[model samples]
Target: MWELFLTGVDAVMSVQIMILIVLGVAVGIVFGAVPGLTAVMAIALCLPLTYALGPAAGLSLLVALFVGATSGALISAILLKIPGTPSSVATTFDGGPMMEKGEGVKALGAGVVFSFLGTIASIIALMTIAPLLAKVALRFGPHEYFAIAVFSLTLIATLSTGSMVKGLFAGTLGFAFATVGIAPVDAIRRFTFDEPNLNSGFDMLVVLIGIFAISEVIKVAESVRSGKNAAIGSVSMKSIKGFGFSMKEFFGQIPNATRSALIGIGIGILPGIGAGTSNIVSYIVAKKRSKYPEKFGTGVLDGVVASETANNAGIGGAMIPLLTLGIPGDAVTAILLGGFMIHGIQPGPMLFISQGALVYTIFVALIVSAVLMLLLEFYGLRIFIKLLAVPKHILLPIILVLCVVGAFGLSSRVFDVWTILLFGLIGYGFVKGGIPPAPFIIGFILGPMAETNLRRGLMLSDGNFVGFLTNPISGAFLLLAVLSVAWHVVGSLRARKNASTELAQA
Candidate 1:
């Protein structure tokens, strides 16, 4: 094993592989910094370029891009208050506020540093316990998946910033939208309304662009129309040195960052759920565990730490299943599986035996890419901040154009563009009505998973509902889901009671 590892390290040290890693990371950062673009798009566009290279070099480039793209999202999330990718949605909750508070540099620094730590931590896990983790993931069945989805759905309560009722409503609305496509098992079309576009449902990317990006553009336009300052905000680099944070502060967040990394790894190992879900889940857990939960969305370093750490850590986590079981952990890995296949390499239990040196090459490449990502972002922090200096009128139009391009680029359909416009209006309405969009996104992503698995679990159990309870893993999650709702209800009741008592005393 030591010999193979050393050989892999040597292979990655070559100039050709090193140059590809740098180029891939640079391109990935650009894609992720753009609001409408994403890592998936970056990988897809550059995948063809890899066909001309060797297996080790090609996979190395893809791995580097994955690392860079996941970390780069924090840039736009902090600077523009728009998530550069779905993985960064939770980032905007605090990152935007931090930018407004003139803590942009600090937020970016925390994001960058923790991203490196998170990736390193996961890579260690990938190197040591990948096979063990993959075996554990194999234990999951439809029942367990359904229970997990239920538990995740209940977490929307934690995201309810202003009103729980509004949050629940938004989540339900998102689920309803998700139901627009064909029903999972029955293969029956319910909400197509005789339109072909609605048959496949709205793309998640399009929805994100519409809700966050387009709604933001609309909000800015409204602010300008109302004679308010149209400029988003400004950040300063003066007198700020070394990540704009203290060692004490970094030490303070060690526990939070560690816990968030674990959450990211656990979630990333699951098929379908990737960094997109883990980042938000990690943020919610961080807020819940914080000494002062109220301080979370108020421009704190903890928020950025939790988000960036989990999402990037997911890079290594996602690879575990892909390498050990030949299963794709998420969309990016699904594409990566294709990259593996194209190179005549199959990833599975025998992969380590069949291609020991190549496997280690990927591991080594991941580490190099992580280091490059840290260095690049460290130096590029100011350049990201400079984006804020661009005039809103000019910047927003460019963003809108990119959003359209990204939407149309999905399936080369104009309907997706229209979908963005429609959802943008809905999102604008959400903003006007004091509803948080995060819960809606969560619901949209998980609702279908829960529903499909529920149906499958029932079928497997011969139409017996008791099967869900019989499975210990599923039962435990379901119980926790119930407890989560009850806990929130109890907390809300107590707060109201206290308010009433104070009023009576007054």
Candidate 2:
């Protein structure tokens, strides 16, 4: 192992590999910091360019981009109160609040630092116990996957702020929209309305950009119409040092960061599920475990730590299954699997033996990219904050244009542009109606996973509904989901009872 490590270090230390790593990280950060662009989009666009490069160099570049893009999400999540990527959704909950409190620098610093830690943690896992974990992941059947999806969907209740009914409604609406595409197994179209564009269903990017970016633009337009100042409030950066956080505070968050990283890794090891889910789940777990749960969305560092750490850690977690089992863990890794195939490389149990040097090169490149991400984000924090100085009227229009371009670029379909517009209006309506958007996003992502797996699981069990409960892993998760609902119901009843008692006494 030491010899292979040294071989990898030697291969990746070449100037060509080093340069590609730097370039990829830089470009990835740009993509991740911008709304409407994602690491998947970045990798997809740049994938063709890698054909000219060697397998090791090309994989290095892609891995670097993956690392930087994942970490870069925190910038927009903090500065603009919008998640630049789906993985950063939970970051906006606390990061937006921190920015409002003039602690934008602190939020960015914590995000960057914890992101580095999370990536490093996962890298260590990949290096040491990847095969072991991959074997464990293989035990997850369709039943287990459905259970996991259902369990994750239940977390939307935790994300709901005020009205559970509205939250569930938003979640159900998102699931309904997901159903617009073709049915998974039967291949029968449901809600396409004879439009060719609807056959493929709504793209996640379109939905995200519409709900977050376009809706934000509309909200700002409303403020401008009302003659309210359309500028983001100024944030102070003076006298800030070393990631804008204290060592004491850093030490305090070690447990939270560790737990979040573990969650990210676990989620990433599962095929189909990705950091997009892990970040939000981590935030919920952090809040549940927090001594100050009430402060989660109110500009707390713990929330940022939980979110950033988990999402970035997923990079390594996603890689574990991809490399050891030839299974792509998430959408980004699925694309990465293509990159490997394009280079005439196949990943599986034999990959480590057949391409040990290249594998180590990837490991080295990941470490280098992580370090670069930390350095670049730290230096770039000032530049990111400068965007806050741009008047919202001016800045928002540029963002709006980017969102349109991004939506149109997905498949070059004008219908997607229209889809974004429609969803944008719907999102704006959601704001006006006191509905939370997070639950909707959760439902949109998890509902399909649950549905597809439920169908498959039932088929595998000869249409027996009891099959899901017979599997220990699936049964455990389902029980947890039920317990979660029951706990919340009991809590609500107690709260109403207490309120009634107070009213009677008065």
How many backbone clashes are present in model 2? 0
Total backbone collisions for each predicted model:
0, 0
**lDDT score, candidate 2, position 37:** 60
Model 2: lDDT of residue 496? 98
Tens-digit lDDT track for model 1 on 140-254? Answer: 7889878877776665544356677787788788778889889999989878989988888877667766777678778878755454322344567678888889999999999
lDDT of each: 0.81, 0.81
Candidate 1, which ten residues in sequence have the lowest lDDT sum?
224-233
Off by over 4 Å in 2: 1-115, 122-133, 157-160, 224-366, 380-382
Residues 257-363 of candidate 2 have per-residue lDDT tens digits of 99999999988776546788899999999999999999889999999999999999999998986787565555577567767866889776567778877888899
Off-target runs (Cα >4 Å) in candidate 1 are 1-115, 122-131, 157-160, 224-366
Task: For each candidate in turn, give its C-alpha RMSD to the true structure in angstroms.
Answer: 7.3, 7.0
Residue pairs of candidate 1 with colliding backbone atoms? none
